[model samples]
Target: MKKAEEVRRLERDRIKNNIVVTSTDAKGKSHEDIIHAEQIGTKIITSELENTAGKERVMKNKHKQLQERIFINNKLTWEEREKRKKMKQRMEEEKKKGRTANMGYQKITIDGKQWK
Candidate 1:
């Protein structure tokens, strides 16, 4: 049989082990009463792929730079802008040529689901 002090200590330890934490997500939504180390619960915080987010951030920066160059930067002469456009076009064409020359085909199809 357990002593009275041991029973009280066990109850106190159980209460201390059950921890609750609240947190907010990227969308400014607040989560409440998030119990720790439980089987059933809502996600207190969300996660995303860093590479995907980095790609989106890079695209946004590129678009902003292009817009600034085309509209805001008046120091660039019209001829200079035209030259830049032509150079971009040439680069695009080169990329297309490279793609056509060596289009990679999947040879190892055994792990189809893993690839997918």
Candidate 2:
């Protein structure tokens, strides 16, 4: 209970403070949240992989440097932005195909079965 409270508090602090990166371990998974926090200049704390051997790679200094870069500028260069736009189009097409292929997947109707 205390740990959960701490995690929530950290998350709230990061958002409220408008930090670039904040590390946290609310889900006990890979320290992906740290990447987010770091990107936004927030420092998060996670005990998931500190003592593990394989995590040494994830804990590398290069990752920290990248976070610093993100903190400086969240935007990509013109070329990179163009590449991202193309990537987004590709992803949208894939999502459309997936939805068309799956019969069980229903489009969300927020009002339930109400016949609009």
Candidate 3:
């Protein structure tokens, strides 16, 4: 049991240290894509931005904007996807029960106090 727990702990730690890389073109717009390194959890970026060529201010602005768009799009998509799935499931269940009321969802709240 101890060995198994150790393995799970290692796996969790590995996931936490993960890093991502995104490269952009000369215009500061994303060139190809924001690539992600998998299990290695580390990224080595190889791009023109390495030298930060061309106008410093313009390049920086473009890079920042591109990164912001990618970050917001990726974050919201992943985070909200699960909630969307739950909503769909609830709607389906309500349909099956022939209920038309708009219902709020309750996550299984386990109160420590037991019913006597």
Per model, state how many residue pairs clash. Answer: 0, 16, 0
Q: 1-116, model 3: which lDDT tens digit per residue? A: 99977876776444332223343322223543323322222322322222223224333445565644422111123323576567667666766777653433323212232211
Best by lDDT: 3
| Model 3 stretches with alpha carbons more than 4 Å out | 19-116
The TM-score obtained by model 1 is 0.22
Candidate 2, residues 45-105: lDDT per residue as tens digits?
3233223242344434335545444211122334444655665555466566663221111
Q: Rank all candidate structures by their TM-score, best first, as comma-separated numbers.
A: 3, 2, 1
The estimated TM-scores of all candidates read: 0.22, 0.24, 0.25
Off by more than 4 A, model 2: 1-73, 99-116
Query: What do the candidate models score in CA lDDT, each in turn?
Result: 0.34, 0.36, 0.38
List the pairs of residues colliding in candidate 1. none
| lDDT agreement of model 1 with the native | 0.34
Least accurate 10 contiguous residues by lDDT in model 1: 100-109
Q: Candidate 1, residues 1-116: lDDT per residue as tens digits? A: 57966875766444432322223221222223223233223423222213434334433444453433321111223344565566555545656666322111211122122111
Q: TM-score of model 3 relative to the true fold?
A: 0.25
Give candidates' CA RMSD values in order. 23.8, 17.0, 12.3
Where does the lowest 10-residue lDDT sum fall in candidate 3? 70-79
